[model samples]
Target: MEASPQYTLTERGPLRAALKTARPQEWVKNVLVFAGVIFSGQLDDTWAIGQALITFACFCAISSAGYFINDLNDVELDRQHPKKRFRPIAAGQLPISAAWVISAVLAVGAIAV
Candidate 1:
């Protein structure tokens, strides 16, 4: 039998891992933030549109931060899942300390926005 290739963490650079940790693909869900404006019939109001956009941005940042924190807490369990094992923290591509720092920054940004 042939041995499968082994990865020793840090497969990608910190920037790439950080981006993956952010999980931009999930941003599509933020579109729901615009529903408030649409339902209120304020689509033509620049202020409402701007508010919705800002809300969407904040939601994305906060949710991304939450995801990072959740991943940090579930690193060990995630390692047992075939797919989740490749997540930045679970796979050891991103350090727990760094994840905490990144998540804090993102959370603060979300609050500020």
Candidate 2:
């Protein structure tokens, strides 16, 4: 039989890899932070809307930080899974050290918000 093609890590730059690790698609969940404002009829209240927006941003940052931590912890296991093997960390597109730093920064920024 012919030899199968090798799967190599793509050189996704640090920024791109970090963005991938952040999983922005999952940030949609954070939009729920505005639910209270919307339900309470504060849509016309600029201050309340602003606060809700800030809360949403903080939640997004924290959630992304959590994702980075989880992916870093599960990197080895992820590499073994057919689908997860493609994750930035699991596939070696992003360095572990960078992931840690990014996670820390995100966590701190979220808290500061």
Give the candidate number with the greatest lDDT. 2
Per-model TM against the reference: 0.81, 0.86
**Model 2 TM-score (2 dp):** 0.86
Badly placed stretches (over 4 Å) of model 2 are 1-11
Candidate 1 stretches greater than 4 Å from native: 1-11
Clashing pairs in 1: none
Which residue pairs show backbone clashes in model 2?
Answer: none
Q: What number of clashing residue pairs does each candidate have, in the order they appear?
A: 0, 0
Instruction: Please give the CA lDDT of all the candidate structures.
Output: 0.90, 0.91
User: On residues 1-113, what C-alpha lDDT tens digit does candidate 2 reach at each position?
Assistant: 99854443354566778898999999998889889999999999999999998998899899999999999999999999999999989999889999999999999999997
Tell me the deviation in Å of residue 23 in model 2. Answer: 0.9
How well is each residue in 1-113 modelled by candidate 1, as lDDT tens digits? 99865543356666678889999899999999899899999999999999999999999999999999999999999999989999989998888899999999999999987
